[model samples]
Target: VAGQAAANQVFNSAFWVTSFLPAVTATLIAKEKAQGNEDGVQDAVCQAIFVGVFIALVTTALCFAKPNQILSSVLSQDAPAMEYARPYLLVRTFAFVPSLISLVGFSAFRGVL
Candidate 1:
């Protein structure tokens, strides 16, 4: 569970930061709507999604490439938990993108609404 916790911390930090994307998207969409530009609204959503995806991809890559480094930083290298955390984090990387995308989708939905 330590590993998952560590991974979640990373994800949560990301969630907090990217959480602004939806608001920005919504604001942009509203502005576009006021200007009568449908394409701009689509562009805003696409841009927000792209940013979210990009961050997720980078995070996934980092987790995949350096699970040890990550866990070591969050947890002591000599800790017994490191062994389990490493493998768990590696496996957990798979969910990163989808998790972030879903968040973006939810936020975007709210924005659009």
Candidate 2:
């Protein structure tokens, strides 16, 4: 039970890192559109995607490199939950880039609307 709780907390916290992407995407689109540069909007979207992927990659690398430390900081070092949560967190980190890209896409669509 403790392990599950810890895992859930870790999972939820990690998602916070991706939460800013939508706002960023929307801002980028709006900026480009206001400047009357449709091409620039597309370019900005591409750049945003690249940036998101890069950040995810860095995050993944860090998580992999220091899973124990991260888990400990988030929970207790000896928490049974850390065992379950660490692997889940590592696996989830891989989804960040793709998820962020999708978010950016949605944001772009929202901007259009």
Candidate 3:
């Protein structure tokens, strides 16, 4: 339970960005397309992809560096499962970038279509 909770915390931290990136990407691309600017649409997609990947990478690195701190905060310092949660959280962090980027890509596609 503690391990799963900790993993959720780490992913949730990045999830907020995921929730909003789509809106930003979709809006930018839609606006550009409405104006008939293919270059601007491409630029918007690229920028959103870059930002999403960058944020995910940074989040993963931070989780890797401070898994204990994250677990402690989410599971409480006295939580007995902190030790177990640490590894679980680290493992889960690896998926952050890929998931985020995939969502961003979908958003871009939705925008284009």
The alpha-carbon RMSD values of the candidates against the true structure, listed in the order shown, are 2.0, 2.1, 1.5
How far out, in Å, is residue 70 in model 1? 1.0
* Candidate 2 weakest lDDT stretch, 10 residues: 3-12
Ranking by lDDT: 3, 2, 1
TM-scores for all predictions = 0.82, 0.81, 0.89
lDDT of 3 at 72: 64
Stretches of candidate 3 exceeding 4 Å from the true structure? none
lDDT of 1 by residue, 15-112 (tens): 57667776777777778877888788788778877988898899889888887777776788887777777777777778877877787677666655
lDDT of 3 at 26: 92
In candidate 2, stretches whose alpha carbon ends up further than 4 angstroms from where it belongs are none
Q: Please list the residue runs of candidate 1 whose C-alpha ends up more than 4 Å from where it truly belongs after superposition.
A: none
Q: How many clashes (backbone N, Cα, C below 3 Å) per candidate?
A: 0, 1, 0
Candidate with more favorable, higher lDDT: 2 or 3 = 3
Candidate 1 local Cα displacement, residue 92, angstroms: 1.9
Poorest 10 consecutive residues of model 3 by lDDT? 9-18
What are the clashing pairs of model 2? 3-81
Worst 10 residues of 1 by lDDT: 6-15
The candidate, 1 or 3, that scores higher on TM-score is 3
